[model samples]
Target chain A: MNAKTSSPIPPAEWIVAGMGLLVFTAVLGLMVWDAVAGDQSPPRITVEVDSITRSGDGHLLKFRARNDGGETAAEVVVEGELPASGGETETASATLDFLPAHSERKGGFFFKAQPERETVRLRASSFREP
Target chain B: MVRRGPKTLMSRRASATHKPAPRGTSRHFLRALARAFAGAIVFGLPLLMTMEMWWLGFHADRGRMALLFILSLPLLVGLSHYSGFEPTFGWVDDVVDTFVACAVGFVSSGVILLLFGLIEPGMAASEVIGKIGLQTLPASIGALLATGQFASPEEREADQKRFRKYQGELFLMMVGAIFLALSMAPTDEMMLIAYMMTPTHVLGLIFLSLVVMHAFVHAVESSGKAYVPSGTPFWSVFLRITIPGYVIALLISALILWAFERTDSCGPATLMGSVIVLGFPAAIGAGASRLII
Candidate 1:
């Protein structure tokens, strides 16, 4: 009969090694999947007017722009327009940088005119590729 | 009469004392896994609870995140060399231990995040992966440190090789500095403190780093548990141990800051500010490693 029946390295170590290999391969695969699946489409920016609330100085017109596409948008310009009772247009704008795909940025445009009495419009003006 | 060779005798002795039975092997693995998980919790729980880390995971650059993963390979190898969770004799064994620790880290991070309700089915895949990946680093280090800190003396002695040389001591300090600096690297407060500090404050921090490192070594020496015996005068020990340790801590601090992209787009002064700010913790970690390891 043989004096011993096993290898120098223990079976437990082999099991641990197998687990490690599984994790490494899985993480690598996920990274590859992310690289391939990301940035396939151009960024589509949409502006949504969330709320108009009264601030101490004026009415705060809070709006957010959502990027629905698969790429990042930089220097995103969003424009807000308040129609006046006197038939004139008042405008405010804000710029956001490096807004990633499937993400949103929120900002507020203060207006002296009461937004509840008039129409408040918010739109995506322009966005550049980051 | 049967003939018994030296190989047979050696194998018999090994099996009798060192080797476990087949059924015991599986049990050993389960216990090791449990220990690793516990280590992950003990060391990584605070970072897991941090909201800033969560935010950083989501907002951090994906490219840098990938780079950090790539850079981590060597650190794992080194950790496995010095303080692996299992008895490893060869390169392959060390590599295996490194991977096992990583797997433990990954699973622990995922489980904790899931329990916290931070991970949801509707979340973006990138976000989910990034958060888990970022947390895996600290958790993996914790797993590596667990065996060193908790293993039975017999089990530890099976693998413990005394790192008594100057190079080994320096390497240990580097590893400890990196580990400790990492705990604070992901926070927003690093940059905030850097921004808030004046030039005078930066000088004070540098002085503090040196003084603290020296005092730690001095205290250890006075306590008579000095790991590396100083055979020379005060100047020699100061130059060899304290000054070099502080320098390594500063370098590690700078490297860690750069890895976290904390120094990105900053001027030299600001970069130095961040490095010195983080160096405070790194230096303490460096000094304390001597006593622990």
Candidate 2:
């Protein structure tokens, strides 16, 4: 007993120091990990118009369904044109759940001139959302 | 008979007492001043230091621009010392010195750290580990505080009091980090919880850094006044504290800018504020403590 416990330093001090070092190393690793992993992706929308003719001729804008994000986009829509007359597109008329992240979902609508008699209103009623 | 070493009991008993208001004539009033004004001026400095940034950010919002410019006026009060780059006072100089020391420390330690990360198995593994370490500053600060890394006491009595008194500020810093990360994280996309650094963050970091470093440097410098042991160089101590912190700041800044550009209305303020508020002070505090000592 005398030989083994010769050192008079408090036993707790060593214990405290050891625990502190362990915690420090653990935390140092965590800081590095958090730096890489923390930021949650933000909501976004990217349009994919398969084809388009001319600005005057107008074109039907289509959306590839699927959020191109870590998480889903809350709501997304396309607005290709707005004629001077007629009713606009509404959510009831458009696609839903068409876009998922990392995949393409096809959604589309036609663009036609109002024929000069009445102007058609082409509002963004066609939407595919999160 | 047992040869009783120098009675450590006296020192232990002395430290046991937690008294009110720091003692004696060594400008303890200044400590009080720190406490009193900490809230008000701490409130004011971040708005000031980053005001130039704010002006650049929302030049469109004329009213907001005007408001920020006005709110941060008092922040420039300490400009003479900061701009002069002179260590006019003992403690004040320590603050500036720690900042410089940290920069030096960062460069040296970063090279070593980069090497550590590149060492085959450790590189991939450490990279994963490193990400975990970056969550919040408290965990690191808690470690540093626990390590007894702060500067040595000139008069042991006063130093102890100072440590006890400011422990709240440190704990607050810890709490602040959690709040900042939470608010900045995408809990709800509609968080308008003062996402800017608001000068509060900068001042808090500065004061906390100064406090911790002042204590640390004093401990190392004053204690070693008698003798400096082998293998412990001033530069290495400084670097050990600095490298991790400065690297964290730089990395956070880069990430903030990247995120800002990538996302809508995801400005640099939140990230900057979080770094300045959450990470900066504690890292600096811990760095100041360890390196100074």
Candidate 3:
């Protein structure tokens, strides 16, 4: 078996092996990077009730922020605000019973946003899929 | 283009028999049926899934083919058990599977729903990631832990190369599954509609399929040389890569579904009747992949 058949395998074979090995490393590196950089597991939703308010015209609202989710939703606890849109904010308790457990609930609060007072845009994080 | 098996395939005459027989009893018939069925499922499902997405996208405001296919994929696992071809490997197949699965999975995993939830309002990226993390971390950790120690490292590393390929395939399947879900979701921002669907019953079925199929695919093939084929082009790549992805996606979907169930949702179906009907094919056929073992 001289140079014709296979005296010895060509150095290119080693090159091919090296290339394959390189590709594996690169992919593994990428997977590891993704696992670290991304690695976001999932998401849980929890809601909090911040403030209960009563407006001047007569409406109620409960302020809330979510602990681990997107929206900081407000529920109507007292429901006296103007049907069109006018109200006040007040602090209160007993709003807990108003919300159904194991569910996201909305309620009217005693608080109202004065159309005049700079508009308080409620901000929150985006909702990521679970 | 190329379509489902037996019906339009070269061996239509034999496939017409539709009888299940041992290898030699009717070798050509079974092979034909397998090829035809394989052709239908491999080419057909994707096409159908793609069409559904297209329909949704065109007909509705927000339609995604990949997401729809990914999400609806569980339905196929049950169906596929009845079909005759399985996914195996060639480089091209692996690549396609990965891309398709990733695109679809990301969309279905509530990504669309999150967008809708915020479209009414708006949410920041950090808030989104953070919120998602909070919801997912505990669950992910619990799952990773509960799955417990692999009874064998010899098992995982048994065929590292094959295992990696298998993992990659499974990942693609997950993406495909989610795409299926997203595609089905009507584009309009109806939180009520999407959420109503998310109640875990429908989602649970998808997850369960993923788990059973994934466990089978991985456990069996993970331990041996994956069925890598000779030189290939289109079909080889298409089939090789996507099949494993399909299996893995099945499992990932299940985990996602299970998580949804755990947190808060509708009542779990307490009946063996419904669960059994749904679960049998996926469990048994996926288990058959142990043939690879």
Candidate 4:
């Protein structure tokens, strides 16, 4: 309480408090905006076979998936398949744990045969709403 | 050193109350800023690196996130009251320090998350705030605790003396519980462990939490007379401190789970199971605070 002693509210404390209040207010405003006017749609995934490259005795089928919707997609199952000569299929899959809205996840599957020559199909099997 | 509790409120009310010696002011702002930076890195880096935490920030319920922020206010106040980075002379000063710690935490989280590309401009407003806000809890606590941990020996000694009060002890336990609980809250493992446990295992865990809480507090108390006394009736210590510490740990675990939306789809039985599973580590952290913090 003395004049020479530290004040209960120091000048520097005010600066710190102001900075904190500014951030807190900005964050709160953003959150409020998201709550009131944000998008509430679910995640929509589109899977594509980007490229087929040759690997050792096999073909590496590169694939990519994009989440173009509002929410996140969890455990997105992307399946790549090559129909074989005997009506059989060689399938490889990759499961992405999470893919946020407007984001992309790249992954691939490998086939023993040349995917460029074989009937290769890449598709999004399933995804959960995260 | 004098130990007093009831006198604290009275002395605090009086305008003429004594203040601890002021820390030197030649580089006060710079020193505080540096401490806050150090605290943020020490406490917040792990959460920033967690992929699940990034996922949770976007998908988690926004209402609950706001509620968690609301709850953090009082917790910060309590932390400042007991072991803040700077010595506070009154409630108003404590409030100011709490804000400062919050600012440091928010800035630190924003910078680090941005550097990691966890937050992108393309993301929604909620996503950015949620990510930074979630990390702020522990970072702010670290900022508040920075003073005591990084202070000169004399100042550290002075702060240690303040921890003798009952409320101070409780606040320490809460900090420890929150720190440990939060470290694992964003992981799938908590729910995985809950699923693996039978009802009987949950009961066993509850018993284990109490036992450990009691044992650790007893050991800390008996080892030093400077600690809160343990010579009183055994039942009193067990009921007053140990039980309450375990309860605090359980509540902290539940709060963390709820904030992360781990309990959204869970039934009440499963929710209780999850709390108990996480409560085990939380209780241990609470008890171990006597030695660690």
Candidate 5:
């Protein structure tokens, strides 16, 4: 098998391969840890307005939905409510396909009335179990 | 690239076999690493583009993912023994090659997925790891097989000869089956199609899968006289290799489905249906592994 006479591997090759081994080990460790003792809470989604942009004839409320729990939330519905002075609540809603745990997804809601920073409220309305 | 068939195998036998490429230099090793990268992209791009695969990265069972990772190591080692990036002289060399290929797979997957916007800076470490880790196995196997793909036909023929034994052939079939099955198992269509099929459809598919698999392998085996004796009866080869190869494909299909959590909600009938459906592609892969890998 030429075991005795085989050439030594390049040092750089060894270093890269070692790094590879480290990568695999870290991934496997994280997965195992997650399976064993990682977070068990259901998906907790929170939405926040990122910016207000003026579109043609309307304003776009850009938001980021962040999932802080241990599970994935699918079909997450985020709503932005603008309470008008006439006891009417104008709601702009957007549905995110998924908000995975510890991850963030970007979405936007459009409203005809210019929303004030103080009265504009953003909330995750609902999410289904993924 | 030269297309190698039984003719090349036969022609190469009259001349002396070519020596395996030398290993150990940094430049040479780096070249092999580059080939590994190319291979990773070639084999892994389909799955990387699949949305279901991305979803499974975070939502699939962690234990099953871990199990698949653990199982891939031995599979990589065996693959390295046969056709690693650079020729290896010992088990240590093969192990080194295995790790190198894995690193190549991991890095390539990360880089490509990031470019696709599937992975980003703020993404959770678990999700990023899961996505890349799941892709590493197929890419690593591709990295290992890269050598054969790029080698001269004679070198590839020699490599094939190393694993020409019955057990070796079976192992190769399993690898091929797993490779093809992994690509298809993550899609919801596997279940959807299974759900759409009736008992008669399922039966027809099974019969068709067997016929296609046997026909392909038989053609390949017959073309290469070294693979089977010329006088061997059709039923003998059918029973000995084709049937067993299909069984391996089905088992691999089932394993991949279970690993991806596709079978979690399935009843026995549905599970069997999906396995058979996947078995079709896997069987094709197994039968044609000799040509591709």
Candidate 6:
């Protein structure tokens, strides 16, 4: 211990230090509870269209990808498909960097053909374990 | 055990000139807190910007995170003992400084994450807490080190004098190892590099790490901030400091890897390889800490 201080500590400084103690205790408590009892379910991803809007040459399909489980999903690929008149399906895909457990990420796909709400099919194609 | 140095004399003279009122004391604390914020940003920016760090925040093993958090209190206390934002007189001051550093770490991390858009509105509380909490330890250490990093030469000498004991030296090495390891351990590249290397490469890397660590220690010693007393045998210094320092680095690397969940899926061989890969930087950090701190 280097004993150099001679002045008494200010009350305001002590109050701030007390607040810091509270923050540390709360975070420590949360971490302990999470470690002992929190869920560890694998990622369960669900993709849904949020809105369809027009871009320059194509319509942009904005979608939300939600992770409903307790693990994070990475490189999440979502696909949107629309059935064409010629019987071929028009497919557009988007990738999200990460969808943390119990969290949502927003992404968009572009399609030249306008997609109807009922006919547009959106699905989370795949996700890598993170 | 009090070593009266120039710093003490300077402080005494200053106090004699003007008695420090409560307002002055509070203002001094505020300045230290500001320095802590700057230190947190300087040391924590890389991890704050790293993508793997963000992902690990949510998915990392909670038990390990808790353990890391628990370990950080003592680490910060020890660091505060050496070079806190301000000089501390006792254990109570050291503990108070530790918490204040943590508070600075948390606030700095939160504000930066928000500015970067990593923490968005309506985000899960757990995710936000996880990200901020995971970053807090390293940033707190940085906060504790602000004074050492920015001190006047005389003040730095005084601080360094307090850590001349063997235990104190080793503790500083551990802090250095953890600081560097925390920044590098969360990356996928550690695994990828380990996977790409053959056994011969691993052996080569092990030899290189030891040589580099020893070289750093030797350089520091020759520069006159000598940890090795004069007339000490070469092999004795090597055995006493360099070897143990390297071992501490390796252990820290392994611990950090486990904390980041990088070892969860790997086999023993891969795990060992990853540890060695990370150990290189940790060794450098350990060796260089003597010079830096």
Which candidate ranks first by TM-score, i.e. highest? 5
Q: CAPRI verdict on model 4?
A: acceptable
The window of 10 residues in a row where model 1 chain A has the poorest summed lDDT is A1-10
Model 1 — TM-score against the truth? 0.73
Q: What DockQ score does model 2 reach against the true complex?
A: 0.03
Q: Which stretches of candidate 6 lie over 4 Å from their true place?
A: A1-6, A85-88, B1-24
Q: Per-residue alpha-carbon lDDT of model 5 for A84-109, expressed as tens digits?
A: 87899899889999888899999888
Mark the 10 consecutive residues where model 2 chain B has the least summed lDDT: B79-88
Q: Residue B75: error of model 5 in Å? A: 0.8
Instruction: Tell me, by lDDT, which candidate is best.
Output: 5
List DockQ, one per candidate, in order: 0.20, 0.03, 0.03, 0.34, 0.73, 0.58
Q: Write down the worst ten-residue block by lDDT for model 1 chain B.
A: B1-10
* Candidate 1 lDDT tens digits, B104-166: 898899999999987765345666777788888889888887776656554554434444556
Write one digit per residue (lDDT tens) for candidate 3, span B11-89: 3444456543322223533342233323322322332333222222111111122232333334333222211121213
Error of 4 at B64 (Å): 0.9
Residues B18-122 of candidate 5 have per-residue lDDT tens digits of 443456678778778888888888888888899998898888788999999999999999888877777676898889889998899999988988898998866
**10 residues in a row with least lDDT, candidate 3 chain A:** A94-103
Interface C-alpha root-mean-square deviation, candidates in order? 4.6, 17.1, 17.2, 3.2, 1.5, 2.1
- Judge the docking of candidate 5 as incorrect, acceptable, medium or high: medium
Off by over 4 Å in 4: A1-5, A8-13, A46-68, A77-95, A102-125, B1-26, B120-122, B223-227
In model 5, the fraction of reference contacts reproduced equals 0.75
Residues A63-124, model 2: lDDT tens digits: 44443443333345544444434465322124443332333445565555422213222223
> How close to the true structure is residue A104 of candidate 1, measured as C-alpha lDDT?
69
Alpha-carbon deviation at B94 in model 2, angstroms: 38
**TM-score, every prediction:** 0.73, 0.24, 0.27, 0.79, 0.93, 0.89
User: Where does candidate 5 clash, by residue pair?
Assistant: none
DockQ winner:
5
**Model 1 clash tally, residue pairs:** 0
